[model samples]
Target: MNITKYVLVLLVMPFLFGCNSDDYQYPDKYLPNYNFSIDIDMSLPLYTPLQFTANPVYIDQAGIGINGIIVMNTGGGYVAYEASCPNQNLDSCSKLAVDGIMAICPCDEAEYNLFNGQAEGKEYPLKPYRIQVTSGTSIRVYN
Candidate 1:
């Protein structure tokens, strides 16, 4: 019985730990970093419609460092994505347009889901920023 137990232990040990390979692979960086801040006042006509699953709003103000930023209400919470193409460099044609839940890039016609920033049929996703509700009347988007 002891010999049988030892053989069982030896079999289990390899399966328990397996191989420890430190080498791992990751995808390459494909987007530029642009600093920006956006303040949403719900009382403002421009942002009033953003409650949940509504049309996304494109914000263009002095403090938004790049061309602009896109803000949307995902029906659960708020999400914001950089209004630029992740697969391509910044250019006039690379700016994104929102149609329903997707952000479309004019240059390549690549589409990314606004809720999670995952591109459709592509490995690269949209560059995302951080957003939080400051109050019942306001939201802040920053990177």
Candidate 2:
């Protein structure tokens, strides 16, 4: 094609399809507002299970988010997600319960992979927080 036509196409292509857009943006309710990190002690009972799909720790001590945070060790890495369901309206049944390697929304059975916090069979993924390894056996999950 022509040089000018090629240049115009290249410039307009990026805008037509967002080159750096994030395809997995969740709604506001699924995210948390508190800007704080909670230090987890692996020596604790709830956190002792570091397996792939084990019991998740309901850490209410963080004093943030809807209910609190649920930390799960994904075998390779650790992920911390908001305890409440991100897709459903805030309700008593919106709390997510851990079953195997997924976080299940009690209201609609919307499951999310705890490893990457991606909601299974849903458009939006689970709301995720930042996790920093503090030590050999400790990590801090922050909003």
User: Among these predicted structures, which one has the highest lDDT?
Assistant: 1
- Pairs with steric clashes in candidate 1: none
> After aligning candidate 2 to the native by TM-score, how far in Å is the CA of 18 from where it should be?
14
lDDT tens readout by residue for model 1, 1-143: 99999999999998778756532222336555667677789788989878657568888676573557888888888887777777877777977888887889999988888888898687677766778899987999987
lDDT of 2: 0.75
Predicted candidate 2: what Cα RMSD to the true structure? 3.8
Off by over 4 Å in 1: 1-30, 63-65
Mind giving the per-residue lDDT tens digits that candidate 2 earns over 1-143? 69999999999998888855335344685554667778877866667774434556767764756678788876667878888887777788988887877888899988887777787577667777777888877888886
The ten-residue window of minimal lDDT in model 1 covers: 21-30
Candidate 2, run of 10 with poorest lDDT = 18-27
Tell me the TM-score of each prediction against the true structure. Answer: 0.73, 0.72
lDDT of each: 0.77, 0.75
